[model samples]
Target chain A: MYERTIDDTVTTFGVSGKLWRDSMIMYDRATESLWSHITGECFRGAHEGAKLAVVPSTQTTWAEWRTHHPGSRILFKPGGKGEGSHYRRYFDDPARFGIHGRGIDDDRLAGKDLVLGVRFGDDRVAYPIAAFGDASVRNDSIAGVPVVLIYMKESEAVHVYERTADEKTVHFEPVIAENGLLMRDRETGSLWNPARGEGIEGPRAGNRLERIPATKIFWFAWQTFYPRSRIGGID
Target chain B: MTGTAVLFTLLLQASAPFERSQEVLMGDTLYSVLPLDAIPAIDEPQFVPVAVADTFLAPTEMIIGVSIDGDDRAYSAWQLDEHEIVNDVVGGVPIAVTW
Candidate 1:
């Protein structure tokens, strides 16, 4: 039972019309992604094809979402037999964090907005901005465990771990640049460079070694209290 | 007979200080948290039930010293005051108490 104060209007790629769920309410931050009993279509709740997006910060009223979307269309009807018709079933689905209802005037979302853009002037660079769960819930088989997913300016989704544990994945894409290298331990400022013969340790010790050129580098490592889950998945 | 007398004298020597409290000692029983010689024992939750105050008294201090599931650490008590029992699943474990 985690409590979070939400105050931003979440804008999405395929959503339109007045924002039904007001942003100024305190909601349980559960289910990071939009989900649906429907197969193909998606919504703001935890479901496939639906990604976490930032809510708009400043706005006098809920009608402002119309201005952001402009040409976006929303299908209010129920889901059809198959294909795109399933999209309509998501109309009334609650947002992943238990945010719902209307007529609640909230001031917190009055100006909180999410800024999406390409980083380092590269079109290939897509900074993951939103994720529903963090690491604690990611590795667990349980459906929900305070998921702590995160998105960086130029990386994929990540799970946030509560405590460093055994067999848990500590996923991070460390970017190393020319004249500067990515460090494994951020606090200690340790550099990871293949050209400099900085040997990789732990699970992926003898795998395909890449040189950490002083450019953009992204590397991932999993932290486990016990070293049971080896590379290529636990047997 | 001489060995028996010596043993009696040793018992008398050892029981001198506990003699007065020996009446109260009838109700008290020593409980060991771990087996006779278990290594790498946990020092937390320093309470264990060796005897029942009454026949209806259930064992409340039952805690796992170590893993029963390869490397999982858990306690029989919910520890709900600490609020850590929200999203865990134990299939066939016995339930002494539910917070």
Candidate 2:
């Protein structure tokens, strides 16, 4: 869900086959430090307390990604036999999946409901997928900073961007274009692609919206790590 | 070799067993979460380039798309599911793609 670059070196990482609070722990080879996959922070080893830099990334379907980045390269298993998914059953019935330990329960949302969580400074906000029903753009603010959350149903991808550009506040509304859902700024009518976070046309052309790193994860998992996070729809 | 030389070599090997200091300062007990090398981390992963249309991945498959310095790349979750780690370079930036 995040780029894996630690310090100046792009350290290689591997799954430690370990879990802390039901989250995956990754180990970097360069320093042998253990990191939480969700937080991307080194919790153990010589690089303890070191954090990997956050790179804005999108989790989208292959078709949607290909539509935008046709020339992009994709990873393929060298000798993969097409075994489907190891988490197929887990995804099918996420609610029934038992989580170990106790004192980590939060019934704010269904344990399996998917949420796009963003953290700015000490403020954390979670936007449930259900809140965006048919709308692709949700203009809102986090910690008093104007932000826009964009959701695409076709690929089930979500992106968050700062709504301010050139010291001016900008609001975005969803417009169904030939390609897919495109955002139009209310101020200058500039069209923006939510996926790329760039203004494609109009007065704001060449302007890029700053993206906030977010994670698309289950509500329970998000809450477990970020108990103080605000649920967008709830409060 | 001579018996005396062979005995000395054996003693040297016995004295220098392959052991790394297990001291770790983190709160969590060392190896308490999982033993070292339990999942076998990928040191250096292999990457092959192919046309986007020939990726052979399902349309709904999830990917981690990263664009840095104008060079973009996508790491397939399915492929990462198998190896759990990939060390790659793109646009002069080194990155580790992990599932």
- Measured by TM-score, the strongest candidate is 2
The deviation in Å at residue A190 for candidate 1 is 10
Instruction: For residues B5-54, write the lDDT of model 1, one tens digit per residue.
Output: 11122223345443432222113221111122121111112222222111
The TM-score measured for candidate 2 stands at 0.51
Please give the lDDT score for candidate 2: 0.65
Top DockQ model:
2
Judge the docking of candidate 2 as incorrect, acceptable, medium or high.
Answer: incorrect
Identify the leading candidate in terms of lDDT.
2
Tens digit per residue, CA lDDT, model 1, A1-235: 1101122332111111111111001111233332111111234444444322221111111133223333322211122122232211212222211011122122211111121111111111111222212221112111222111222222221222221213332222344455433323233233333222242554443332221111111111010111121111110
Please tell me how candidate 1 rates in CAPRI terms.
incorrect
Q: What is the TM-score of chain B alone in each candidate?
A: 0.19, 0.53
**Please, what are the lDDT tens digits per residue for candidate 2 over residues A154-203?**
65666889999889989899999997899999998999988879999999
After best superposition, candidate 2 residue B99: deviation in angstroms? Answer: 3.6
**Candidate 2 displacement at residue A220 in angstroms:** 8.3
